[model samples]
Target chain A: DVKVTQSSRYLVKRTGEKVFLECVQDMDHENMFWYRQDPGLGLRLIYFSYDVKMKEKGDIPEGYSVSREKKERFSLILESASTNQTSMYLCASSLLDRSNQPQHFGDGTRLSIL
Target chain B: AQTVTQSQPEMSVQEAETVTLSCTYDTSESNYYLFWYKQPPSRQMILVIRQEAYKQQNATENRFSVNFQKAAKSFSLKISDSQLGDTAMYFCASEHTSGSRLTFGEGTQLTVNP
Candidate 1:
């Protein structure tokens, strides 16, 4: 079975603070993604990394950045957290194959910005 | 750009009953994949079922199955003999076979009343 682990299950941060959400996958998948899920709005992609040091912006990438220094770890960084950023963050990983690979997700981190 | 839609925001069903969740997507690509994911109270996103657009047959997994209508671009999930453990937020998602990202629906909150 594939295991995707997130660094934090819940987090609280003050406005204008820097925040980091980490995700690690044991499957060594080549593609990793970060998404923020909000009520009514659903899950929107924030950023994704296809390989080490290679990142791409998803639908809603503003105020967020990503780091993929290693194959097994992907990190989501908020330049400065705002109240609007409070939401459940999810991380997922998939194999390099794009044809028929399904993404495996980690337990989400619910971030609260005060 | 691809977009997924789940019109029903919330649904309820009695235990041991059957329930269906609807999903629709709009995309110009002919080759793509569809997925249904369940996120229980634990906030872990688990893949429920998947379907390839090229396949004419719908996909099924035990008590979980999908009604895929390619002409309508609709993919609905049916859960038979639903159990209390089946209560969760179900999200429908789609991805182009050539792309690395997925487009997700807003999600339907399913509650199984015992």
Candidate 2:
């Protein structure tokens, strides 16, 4: 079984603070993703990394960035946390293969910005 | 941009009964994949089922199945003999064949009553 682990299950930050969310996958998948989930607006991709040091902006990448210094770890950075940024964040990983393998997700981190 | 839609916001069904959740997507890309994901209260996203756009037959997994209509761009999930454990937020998503990002719809909250 594949295991994806997020560093924090619940987080709180003040406005204008820098926040980091960490994720690690044991499967060594080549693709890692960060998503923000909000009510009435499903999960939206924030950023994704296909390989170490390679990152791409997803549909809603504003105010957020990602780091993939190693194959097994991906981190999401909130440049300046705002109240509107409070939401559940999810991390997922999948093998970059032709089989179209589904992504395995970690238990999300619910972030609250004060 | 690909857009996935789930019209049903909330649904309820009794244990041992069946329930269907509807999903539709609008995308210009012909080659893509559709998926249904379940997020329980534990906040873990689990892949329920998936269908390739090129496949004519719908996909199924045990008591869960999907009705995929390529021309109409509609994919719906049906859960047979629903159980309390099946209660969760169901999300519909799509991914282009050339990309790894998934576009998701506002989820449907499902509750199985005893």
Candidate 3:
């Protein structure tokens, strides 16, 4: 079975602190994504990486960045955490084949910024 | 920009009944994909079903099926014989064929009453 592992299931950070959320997938997928889910707002894409060292900004990319140094690992970075940034963070990965591939997601990390 | 919308914010259905959740999207791109994802209380986002835009026939997976109306830009999910385990937050998402990013709807909180 494909497994997507998140580094933390829950996290708390102070305002102005730098935070890192890690995601690793064992499926050898080529596409990885980071999204923040808020109540009544659904999941908004923050960033995505299609290949190692390649990244693209999504709809709500401000205050967030991504790093994909290896094929299996993708990281989401919050330059300066703020209370408004508190939400559930999700990581997903999918195969490179565009035909009909579905993304596999990890158990999200609930981040609380204070 | 591609946008997904779920009109229902909350839905409830009795066990062993059928329920449908509505979703609509706006995009000029003809080639794209639609997905229904379930996020249970466990906070794990799971892919429930998917439909390719070019496919004329609807997509079905066991008790879960999608009514895809390409011209109407509507993709609704029908859950037959709903169970208590089916209770979750259902999100409709769209991804363009040219890119890897997905746009999600506000999501519908589904409660399966036993």
Candidate 4:
């Protein structure tokens, strides 16, 4: 089974603090994604990395950035945490294959910004 | 941009009954994939079922199945013999054939009563 491990299951940060959410997938998938799931808005993509050092901004990537220094690890960085940024963060990974493979997601990191 | 919508905000069904969750999407891209994802209270996103735009037959997985109407741009999920474990938030998502990003709907909360 594929396993996506999130560094933190629960996190609390101040408004101006810098936050980092880490994700590691054991499947060595080539594509990794960061998404923030909100109550009524659903899961909005923040950023995605198709390969090491290659990242693309998604619809809701305004206050977020991503890094993929290695194939197994992907990181989501909140430039400065804001109260509005408080939500459940999910990390997903899928193989960059021609076949339609499902993206496996981590348990999720519930971040609370005060 | 592709947008997904789940009209039903909440739905309930008896343990032995069946329930269906509706999903509609707007997209200009002809080649794409539609998916239903289940997010339980544990906050983990699990892929329920997926349907390819080109496939005429709907997809099914055990007790879970999809009613895909390509021309109507509608994809609904039906859970047969509903169980308490089926209680969760069901999200409809779409992904373009050329891209890996998934656009998700607001989600419909499902409850299976005994």
lDDT of 4 at B89: 95
- Superposed Cα deviation of residue A25, candidate 4 (Å): 0.4
Q: For candidate 1, lDDT tens digit of each residue in B1-114? A: 999999999999999999999999999998999999999999989999999999999999999999999999999999999999999999999999988798999999999999
Interface RMSD of each: 0.9, 1.0, 0.9, 1.1
- List model 3 lDDT by residue over A1-114, tens digit each: 889999999999999999999999999999999999998999998999899999999888999988999999999999999899999999999988867888889999999999
- Of candidate 4 chain A, the 10-residue stretch with the lowest lDDT total is A94-103
Which pairs clash (backbone N, Cα, C closer than 3 Å) in model 1? none
DockQ class, candidate 1: high
Winner on DockQ between 1 and 2 is 2
Model 4 lDDT tens row, B1-114: 999999998999999899999999999998999999999999889999999999999999999999999889999999999999999999999998888889999999999999
Window of ten residues with lowest summed lDDT in model 2 chain A: A94-103
Global CA lDDT computed for model 3: 0.94
Fraction of true inter-chain Cα contacts (below 8 Å) kept per model?
Answer: 0.71, 0.89, 0.89, 0.87
DockQ ranking, high to low: 3, 2, 4, 1
The TM-scores, one per candidate, come to: 0.98, 0.98, 0.97, 0.98
Error of 1 at B63 (Å): 0.6
Which candidate, 2 or 3, has the higher TM-score? 2
